[model samples]
Target: MFIFQAAAPGTSIIRRDLGAEPLPQTEALYAVALASPATLAAPPMGSLNLSEALIREVEAADVIVIGTPMHNLTIPSVLKAWIDQILRVGRTMKSTPSGKVGMLRDRPVYIGVASGGFFTGERANQPDFLTPYLSLALSSIGLKTQQFLTLQGPPHWIGARHR
Candidate 1:
């Protein structure tokens, strides 16, 4: 499954130029499940429509790829909304005596985050909220493997690469 966040200006190029695919929501989930046959079913999450379906996608996927662009030194609103949909109480995560226990496990998450400025400690930019927040959020659901590829500035970080 792929989470594409291109709400930021100039990032629409990810689709036209980079040839990326976006994840489907709601009833589309039914189509994919029917086409590919899976043991996934929507869980109880109040009146939310996509929450259960999105969780199933994450759980079924062996690897998750997220494409996002930093906005205002953080993740965009669309991505945040998607996160809210996926992260549900007693479903993706649960409260325990130790703390909150993540339900889903044994999956790798790959995040592609593009930014206009460098985010490493030595860079002029401040600490990146995108990576840390995503780490915590996804970790809460036991999907912990993550890789971030950030492209900074118009020239596109020609000098250095994030490792």
Candidate 2:
């Protein structure tokens, strides 16, 4: 359920060089119930074939790499929708007294994030909501180890913009 963005030219964001299966960026719109009795009852699967396939990919992959653009200081709606599709009730995770516990095996998730403003490092001027939110979201599904590489201020942040 990765609402991924297209990778930069000559860059392989989805490949970890560990024979990781590469999943194409899912641009299709996805908005469905996060969890249901029918889906939760059996093996966690999406009501739609697309979501089901996405879930299976994530499950099988040894590592996950996501390339996305920060939209308005948060993830795009499409990404959120994709996330909703994968975070299943009984499949990817389960509700426990302590909290929602993850059922999937832990893995490393590398994310290449692009931003128009500085979210970290020196001369910071923006509130970074994307990192924390993504951390919690991915961790909920047992993808504990994560590394984020951000390209901030792109071509638009130079000279006067920096000053």
Candidate 3:
């Protein structure tokens, strides 16, 4: 399991700016045999100069975990930046006549999201651009198996919970 941490908890600007309580300094991950038959390795992936380590981690992780806060009804810029690093053209995927095809092996992605407003279920009141966008983005890399865990309520509910 790899905690694809876009921002270290200690320096997570979103959490700080949102006034959320400090995240746990030490986090642990356990992995189960999350597998798929996706083993198509045709388009060789290029390792981004700076993101090579991140790409390696993604390849190694059987289960990937990302914890993020939805900002402005979508993902924070930090998370977006991280995604840009991993979404390599020749590396993670390749362009085909039909469309883009992913070359990396598939894995389970679990996303934990914190939102200031309710966007789904009966209490839905706001437009939800987060989940759909993430679903599309992640699926592009062959990470089709995904689950979202959301915690929504009043603004700063995340902070209050930790405190």
Candidate 4:
């Protein structure tokens, strides 16, 4: 929801709160679903123009950090919609005889995930499909370096003293 960009010690920190001004969900979904070689190659208009704007923001970033709350053991629908808007063929990736290759320069993608229940290791009660899926998704777009920061535990256990 909040994107924080770290800068030099004396430099000012840049912040963009995507949550403050959320994009229309219906518009995002339609843009992604209808995106194709022809649609992207055509004159930049309407939703395609919007997609271009989102792509520009992503392309301009040096480090991309995503803070997301886990919903139903995975990313929320709105976040998925945002991902769909940015991950465009020929822009983020391209097809070739070998396969699809990422066009964006490789960068660090830090994911901050907050979950209600245990979602890691042997004590985990819930299945974690978010981490792997996100990793692959980002890698496919050339953001290979990734780091995850997770805070997991039920609300009831937050202030309980250990025996």
Candidate 5:
């Protein structure tokens, strides 16, 4: 699985625990995958146009995992930047005369969210942009995403256990 951790320092800790290598941010990664022979072989995909470099990463991996610490009620800009790259038109996805068609086959995406407060429903303790937006956006592009595995510290979610 390719882990896209929005938190850098904490992300390294998580990566070490999981025994997985984190993928580089999209730009540096772009050139490696877009090498001459590979691009030449696949004309249907013109991923060179995307500067965000996320498309190459996503296409290369069979599974994707995202680790994030909720900040100010939203996802970090770094992760959002990656999303911008992968959601390219006529590349990872396309709009056609018929309708929107996702070129990517279905892949599983696991989201690891660490938050100080609870925000599962309408009665949100804090504004949350992680769960819903991630679910929707990933679904839009043929990724099967799941609700977060929320690791809430002792202050919250410690007393309750859901079935």
Candidate 6:
């Protein structure tokens, strides 16, 4: 896989399997809203909270690599939940008079996508909401530099017919 190939001498890799791990709960949004001010003022340390854990991961990473399959033209709900947990106001971004501004320093993000059906160029029949949405989300968190690699074909041709 891409991660394995990307791994080399002096490179550190941190992997989070969203499907296997217990994602943040819906209540996490409320918790963030309540803790935003305090967190912004003095960031927590040694916290075991899931949201905090995810935030720390993003903060520590130099380059983020995500590999995912297209599901109904968008990312899975679990990934969306992870996004909600990480995109904390005052922590990842701030609301200014002009608009929301990202606080974290920009970094490069590489997204590998696999699709059963074509979603790019003139042959595309399905609308691609994933790329644009993810771009905006990452940018909101100050990760503006992004590279996307996609493999598109028929379900059977791509050996994804089981899905």
Clashes of each: 0, 0, 2, 0, 0, 0
**TM-score rank order:** 6, 4, 2, 1, 3, 5
Q: What are the models' TM-scores?
A: 0.66, 0.70, 0.65, 0.79, 0.59, 0.80
Candidate number achieving the greatest TM-score relative to the actual structure: 6
CA lDDT, every prediction? 0.64, 0.69, 0.65, 0.72, 0.60, 0.78
Clashing pairs in 3: 45-91, 46-91
After superposition, the stretches of candidate 6 with alpha carbons farther than 4 Å from their true spots are 1-8, 28-48, 158-163
- Give the lDDT of residue 90 in candidate 6: 66
Best by lDDT: 6
Off by over 4 Å in 4: 1-7, 10-14, 26-36, 96-99, 159-163
Residue 49, candidate 6: Cα error in Å is 2.2
What lDDT is reached at residue 149 by model 6? 88
- Of candidate 1, the 10-residue stretch with the lowest lDDT total is 10-19
TM-score of 6: 0.80
How many clashes does the backbone of model 3 have?
2
How far residue 103's Cα lies from its native spot in candidate 6, in Å, is: 1.0
Could you tell me which 10 consecutive residues in candidate 3 have the lowest summed lDDT? 26-35
2 against 6, candidate with superior lDDT: 6
Cα-based RMSD of candidate 2: 8.0
> By the lDDT metric, which is better: model 2 or model 3?
2
